[model samples]
Target: MFALYITHPQVRIDPDVAVPKWGLSDIGSARARLAAESAWAGQLRRIISSNEVKAIETANILASASGVPVEIVEGMHENDRSATGFLPPPEFEMAADWFFAHPHDSFRGWERAIDAQTRIVSKVEAILAEHDPQAPIAFIGHGGVGTLLKCHIAGRPIARQGDQPAGGGNLFCFDLANRAISCDWTPMESWKGESRKG
Candidate 1:
């Protein structure tokens, strides 16, 4: 019995904005559609996503293609970085680095990496427990939290942190039972190739 953890790439919202809810960009939606058609077309028994808008948007596309309803899981959301949400990218990176250096105190306005990991892992474990052991599930989530969740599952201490995925770009799959990883990182150029205009 294994569950598949998949992330929505190119869904990064503007860190300097008060983005309470923003849908995925054009590339993000395309990646999700391709992901459904590629790795998880008929294999997934269920589709789940973080409660955030970008995640939901991505999940909806996957679910539509796969003929599964998207279930929202609030527990699997990205770390709460609402406190310093308006910082520019460079400042945000510095602050995030400081947060990794001080996890215990990282949740003043944002959730600590350790806390976020705990919540996400526990919820995922619970989902596994609730579902049929042999049924496979797919999850859509944000990049920063999704990558950290992988780090936690892999038992690697995150030396540097915040949304930086290793080699995989962002779209990935973690086999819960066998601990295998398969990443379908759509290259930035490839994403640009698929970009659509309104």
Candidate 2:
């Protein structure tokens, strides 16, 4: 079986709002549309996404075209950073640095990398076990969480990080039977000038 792990480009996070759960921005929505178009136009058998508006919106678009209904998976939601929501950019950066420095532990209210890895990998494993080995599955998630999940699937150290550029998208294909990342973070060039990883 093949699985396509994906992520939403960007969400409309209200900088002024203390808790930002804003929907996708104009550009973000565009990127998501393109991502969906690319995946649905290809070989994805099913679509899964986090319940967040941004991811759901993207998944719905693909589902509409693919003639399949979306399955909202709670475990696929973005890594929670509730403990440090709405910090100024600089403070957020500093906190993120600290979080990365200690991946096994949570910084503030954010998810511990180990916990996130466990949940994501477990959920994905269960899904893979249920699907036909010849079919492909797609997931729409957040950038950071998506990259971390990819690392887990690749058998890389959980503490290591990957690029997660803003307004970018990644496509990874996992071959279930062989336990291989058949493909990793293939850049979608339809939307030019944007880095695929942050």
Candidate 3:
């Protein structure tokens, strides 16, 4: 069996709304719906999601298709950026670069990249500890922490180079038994569950 880490797609950007509360944009929803119809989604026996609105929405779509309940797990959220609230794209990009470049340092009071990575990895490990290895599972979350988790699974140091493509809705799979990555980032809507066989 394989476990997939899937990032929520584009989100509705609302400067006044909390980042965790922001829901999916129309495009994001459409992409998620498309992913939900894929063979991969239907194969999921367990769907774990962050408490963030966008992640929950994406998880719900996949769960609906898979007939699996969405399990909202805390600490699976993106690296904490609440310190600076929301920054415009350009500024956010620069901050993100700094965040990744200095994994031990906090960017504008945001959670240190190293810390976030540890949290996500721990959360995932705890969940998998109790998961049925024979069943396929999907974890719905954001790019930052998802990249962190991916880096850990691949045995690479935390780096933004492993980050997903620009608009999200991407997924990467890992073997359930050994936790070895089976695939790299691929758009959720385009993945056909063809990489790793049971």
**TM-score for each prediction?**
0.78, 0.83, 0.98
Q: Which of 2 and 3 is ahead in lDDT?
A: 3
Candidate 2 C-alpha lDDT tens digits along 37-152:
65433555788888777778777766665777789987777678777667776787677677666788788779887777777778877877787776667877776667778887
Order the candidates by TM-score, highest first: 3, 2, 1
CA lDDT scores, all candidates in order: 0.64, 0.68, 0.94
lDDT of 2 at 89: 67
Q: How many clashes in each candidate?
A: 1, 6, 0
Candidate 3 lDDT by residue in tens digits, 1-198: 999999999999999999999999999999999999898889899999999999999999889888989999999999999999999999998999999999999988999999999999999999999999999999999999999999999999989999999999999999999898888999999988856466
**For model 1, the run of ten residues with the poorest summed lDDT:** 189-198
Please give the lDDT score at residue 1 for candidate 2: 58
* lDDT, candidate 3, at 139: 95
Please list all clashing residue pairs in model 1, or write none if there are none.
144-163
TM-score-better candidate, 2 vs 3: 3
Q: Pick by TM-score: which candidate is best? A: 3
Error of 3 at 96 (Å): 0.6
